[model samples]
Target: MTAPVAKLLLKVFTYRQLAVGGGFLAGFGYVYCGIGFALSALPGYIILEDHFQDQFPKALSASSLFNFIGIAVLPPLLQYLKTLFGSREAFILFGAVTWHMIPAGFGLRDAVPRGGCIDRPSVSKRHAKTKRDLKFVNKYLSFCSCLFYHKNYAILVVTEFLSSLIYISWALFLVSLGTSAGLREESAVILSTAAGVGSFLGTALAIGLFHFQKMNAYTSCAVPLLVNGIGLVGLTFARDFNSLLSLTLLTGFCLGVNISGMIGIIPSLVCRYHFQQAVVINYFIDGIAYQFGGLISGAIRDLYGSTLYVYGFAALLSFVALPWILIWACNKDPNRECEPDLS
Candidate 1:
């Protein structure tokens, strides 16, 4: 009787998690899908960039913005959505895809100029069962990585750990570079714009080049990190701040390409359909990445007393990320199929 009761408790715990995690994922996925749906418009990013800048006092630090992303924004968004539409993750996913395609179709037809307002179609029903529909069409956004299981996910996650470290280090270095080079605040703003443009173009190129390639996600990620490392190294030799900014444009753009490519690895890199759990696992690792990156970058900046050396240090650390990149990008994991949740 005790054995049976213990098993019963274990089963209850699992079901409880299914209720909570699944519900959390659903609400979060919904808002995310809604945002994605609207952003399918090409002009959406520019509009957002401007809108965000308009809300601030002027050129607040990027770190501060990230703090907002972590603290104020993401938590509330997750909670509110979970409450408002917890049971309706599938519907949210559908709405997101619909919004994405509708705007895209209009753009193709030249029916509306990019960014023109099209009325949003209303949600026709709201009598949702208030529970996660795990089998909902949201699987289209599921992580489907071949590497995420077996030993490969371990390898790839390790590689991302190192690479993300260097990636963030470079971002931190840029502010110091701007101030030390005596570039006006306005010039720094312009440099950011240039970097954004370059990043967008680079990602576009990756998409075009890898359009038909298998495991393009992995290849796409590796190519950009290699390029970004090279670019950051070159930044050390930049003659002036403007020159530094110019060099950084190349690096930033290359990084932009890799960022999405890295994210695209989620399901394929994780072992199963539990992609959200896998990704949340990464978020845990990434916390250390940010904390340590900032601590080390700041420590070196103070010790070396040179922006050039600080940049060089960041570039060198990027090398540690290389082994992971080489292995994951080059190796084929035999494309194992994920077993469905049978229960």
Candidate 2:
């Protein structure tokens, strides 16, 4: 919906109306992001759960590795494009290339079986009309109700929110923090690149640990949180580029592990049919948390005039959350039968 509309606006508008076009693009971008999150994560996890059930963690790690590569490349690639062409032309070119996704979307197939995670069948016209009438009232209410139905899922949602808050805050401030620590802008950017490399390495390491070492889901999740907390503390004392880069790498590695564990463990925590809903809810909260986290971190940086304080605050929060995760893992129901390979 938003994608096509954004594409159309980009195609029709000229550089003179760039501001108007950008406004339309920003307005629709959030919707597109939300939709993309659901589509990419839910279906991919469902398909992996259905087929590669035993190797879900490895699969998730591999997927995250690829995603990290893209994230690491996109910024520099866009900058290069902006340099080669002016900002207006670069944006136009980007929009034109991205429009290819519409055609590419046609290749997607429903990997889930009929009556699986999501079931939608053709209904009678009358029934469809009736649903439309009630949708306005029921839609948000039902979504809100889902948040409280499952205790484990609710815990995961909280964990995701906090984790996203910390992770995004750190990511958004990493370069600034590096510069504050006496590095040049180019060096700070290089540190960010090092973080990306660390993320790739972390995912690869998680894959190995999950596959060969037989690390359980709980340990996989909790260890990364602990590692990240420690890394954040380390960052508070990092005074030079080398030290900052090392701390950034450590944080990035733990971030990769945490992300993979979160996605990989979902199938183990809930039944197949509920997996998609759980992920959708978790990511929705995560998105909100990320936005607020950035804002809050910015505020903290402004108030304190120090990224160290922000890092310390995030570390403190991480440590505070650690015990709950440990307790949850300790109390996990042994008889639960969502996924046999969770161990």
Candidate 3:
């Protein structure tokens, strides 16, 4: 929703104003998108939890295929459009097409499970005394703080923060790394495309494993993180186009597995009522981490005049996330059942 508005505004604002306005709009869009995703994912997760609980991981992996496809295609598509139509006009055209999501959103059906327990006792009634005792801001702060008190949620927050930090840093510097290695711009783009293809293949493989081999969430998550770390380390040493491209593909594949596994395992982590909040918080943190990652990586790149150190630092961060995830996974009950809810 905010995407189209941002695009339209981009045409009106001067370059300076556009930067400020674009930043605000991008932040707002990230928050809104996080909320929207949580709302949308909740119902689908509920249905999956209720009916297809055993195959939920596979289903999620299958769903991620489209995301990989978009990643693989959208950059070249957008560049072509920009070349053909000019920047502002291209954005306007893309915005016009993006507006179709409004109608598409309306077409979605309710997916609440028939029988489920949700602790939605009236907030007004339940919090009346507390409201009298505390200010609205205080109440809000308290609620947010409680989310992090949960052991699993805490671990998730830490792991996700680290993962996003490293991943975004790598992504922002990838093309620069390629150029530094003497690869042509076209070849760098091809390398990114190959990574996307690898992502698609990784998601497909995860789905196959989930369905046929009954792969566990821990394996799905841990293996990818390890692979991603290794790939990042490999990138620091890669000097040629083929070596860089191969490492990027490996990194992308690991990323795909990590994303699918993280999302797929959410149902196993929290009750349905808390799931939306958890996911929204995770997305919020992820957005912040992405911003910071780019800034930090850019700063380091400028300071050092080399990408090798940046890659090495990101790899170190990736490795740092391993223990948190492993501890959480070790404590998690594999056969634990979630409380189903429609809320």
- Best by TM-score, which number? 3
Model 1: CA > 4 A from native: 1-148, 214-218, 340-343
User: How many times do residue backbones clash in model 3?
Assistant: 0
Q: Model 2 — TM-score against the truth? A: 0.74
lDDT of 1 at 175: 52
Q: Candidate 2 vs candidate 3: which has greater TM-score?
A: 3
lDDT of each: 0.54, 0.70, 0.71
Residue 209 error for model 2, in Å? 3.1
Q: Rank the candidates by TM-score, best first.
A: 3, 2, 1
For candidate 2, write residues 119-225 as lDDT tens digits.
Answer: 23432343355446546534565553333334565566677788888888777777788888898766677666777877788788778877784555455668888
Better of 1 and 3 by TM-score: 3
**What lDDT score goes with residue 88 in model 3?**
86
In model 1, the Cα lDDT at residue 29 comes to 65
Q: List, residue by residue over 155-182, the lDDT tens digit for candidate 3.
A: 7678878888887887677767888888
Q: What is the TM-score of each candidate against the true structure?
A: 0.53, 0.74, 0.74
lDDT of 3 at 90: 83
Instruction: State in Å the error of residue 99, model 2.
Output: 4.8
The candidate maximizing lDDT is 3
